[model samples]
Target: MYKATYFAAALSLALFQSPAVATADEITILAGDLPPMFNADGSGREAEIISTVMERCGHTVSFEIQPFTRHWKTYASGTGDAVATVPVGMPLGGHQSDVYIQYQNGVSFLTDAGNTYGDLAALAGHSVIAFMGASDILPGLKDAASSFKSYKEVADQIGQSRMIFGKRVDAVVGDGMIFAEYNRQLREQSGDLMFDPNQGVTFQAIFEPSSYGMNFRDAQLAEDFNRCFAEADAEGAIEAINSAWAERYRETLGTQYLGH
Candidate 1:
């Protein structure tokens, strides 16, 4: 009788101590403030990608958009659950998912801007505008921008574009797809800005196409995230998201590099 009583108590204690299955919680993604990619104001494609892909995987995502420099601080501290667009081989964090957005970034100019550059050497002589931290990913780009202006956010891209309209600079070097989006927005939304992005501008690709992906703390989460990408691709989510931006990517880097 005493043994039976002890067994019942042990079973009750075991029942009480056992934990419940964890419900997948939301994760915060820290990202650099790159327009059409990591904007906080609902204009970023990567933000949409994170939310969409994570949702498909039964997880939620919140984005913390800040300067490119600030992104590393948040990411390295293990505070942010994930980081968007970590270039391969950066010693910031753990497992990185497969490439989400891949594009060719390079120097480009308006056909009528009268800037002539056939190669990297010729490009070294011209003033150029580029997104922040471009030199880190694209070697020789910063050095080639004789006069360089780099902005840290989406809104700043407008200033970079306006420089072209105002003739402040002869060329801009950055992501081809991002440049196309900026050109589209600056021209359509040019209210008080009054800048025409399509004055026969012809952009040429200078750097090889590059790949980037989300990096996470744990290997399990990263593996799940990669699987989610595969599932998302199968379900047409990735293609849908890229449809708006694929033109520039396809034109510059080809489809193979669209969403690696």
Candidate 2:
């Protein structure tokens, strides 16, 4: 009878301590504040994708949004459990997950400028402006800058649109979506930026797509993310999130957004 009682207690303890009853972990993710992709309030498409995938993996998620370059520094200093939007093969230490997002970087010039960039080489001898640290972040950009008439990088991406609209530069180089978002803001709130937002702009896909992923401090978390992300993607949830954001841009920026 005592043996039976011992077995019952052991079974109860095992049941109580089972993985099925384990509480979900909350993971804090650090990301860049690139709107329409990643926002400070954790409401952007990338944020939604991360939240959805992590939730599917039975984990709660939070975000700490910083500047595009600063987030890498924040991650390096061990500030968060994970960092998103990290380019593949970046030197940051951690278990990197599969490439889950892509940023389409390109060169934008006035559609009326009669400008056509078949490739990065075509950008030669043109005054160009790009996001801060772009030369370092973008492959071959440093070498390409040497041939441009003039090249500069700005921390505030809104300046990319303003500089191009104000005729301060021949072109702006960055993500098409980010540039579109800035243009949308300029159209709504020109303020002191004296430039014609109505002017047609052309985005030339001269560079390769920027593939990004997440890095997790825990290898198990990275594996779990990969599994859950694949599962969510198979269910079409990931594509739905992407399409919803693209539709928002389409409504705001017209059919020109995303080559649509």
Candidate 3:
């Protein structure tokens, strides 16, 4: 009976020590319009991070980009599993769950020169250009949206560059990466126009330092995502992801703006 006991103990150990298998399913991620995070090219840094973690966790993930207001509405309606770039501890209108990603949202100014501004108060009385539905990114500037001397959304980057060249506004305030990337692409196709870092035009300000994470409709999904995210973070995957994008942005800017 010693041999029998030994076999039973081994079996028990196997069962107890084995890692738990995660459920395989497609998870829908809702996100607002943000470049280098969830862009049209599908090369967003956060998108890659989520994809890597979910794949390792035996799940498929997809994203649907919409306006910030609409994204919140859809998530709150309980129709999807999670929304990206959500502020932590955000009171859900109806949805539930606590898992989230960590990041910050801030304002970036693009001007004729590459000058940096420390805060919103610095732009007092200066005309600023921004998109109509970017309140989530620039909460303080929302009130001044109408008072601005100019405003326009060309639905793409080309028109934005044109507007900037035409002096529609003194500067543009929006996602730094988005504006930078778009201008980079524009300068590539046309050498005449370029972003000059030495022009003293670009400035970035952190309106509110907040954590961005995925909000889940169900607690189980949140738990799973959190587990996968933590595992990925421990494995250094998150750092790698950020590094890759940072390098790309630097390269892009170096080539387009710095004229390197």
* lDDT comparison, 1 vs 3, better candidate: 1
lDDT tens digits, residue span 1-260, model 2: 00122123332332222121113488888888888788768888889999999999889998998876567666666577888887676656677899888777777888788888767788899999988767866667888899999999988888788888899998888877778778887888836656687788777666677778887878888999999999999999988887777676563334334444
Candidate lDDT values, in order: 0.63, 0.76, 0.54
Please state every model's RMSD to the true fold in angstroms. Answer: 13.6, 13.0, 14.4
Tens digits of per-residue lDDT for model 1 on 185-223?
777773576555557555666667677777777677677
Give the range of the ten consecutive residues with the poorest summed lDDT in model 3: 1-10
> What's model 1's overall lDDT?
0.63
Candidate 3 off by > 4 Å:
1-24, 93-114, 133-161, 188-203, 251-260
In TM-score terms, candidate 2 sits at 0.81
Q: Give candidate 1 regions above 4 Å deviation.
A: 1-24, 114-118, 122-125, 142-156, 184-198, 234-236, 247-260
Candidate 2 worst ten-residue window by lDDT: 1-10
TM-scores of the candidates in the order shown: 0.71, 0.81, 0.65
Pairs that clash in candidate 2: none
Q: Which scores better on lDDT, 1 or 2? A: 2
Ranking by lDDT: 2, 1, 3
* Model 3: per-residue Cα lDDT over 134-226, one tens digit each: 543455665655555544433464455455555555666655456666665555673554343323235353444334666665566667677
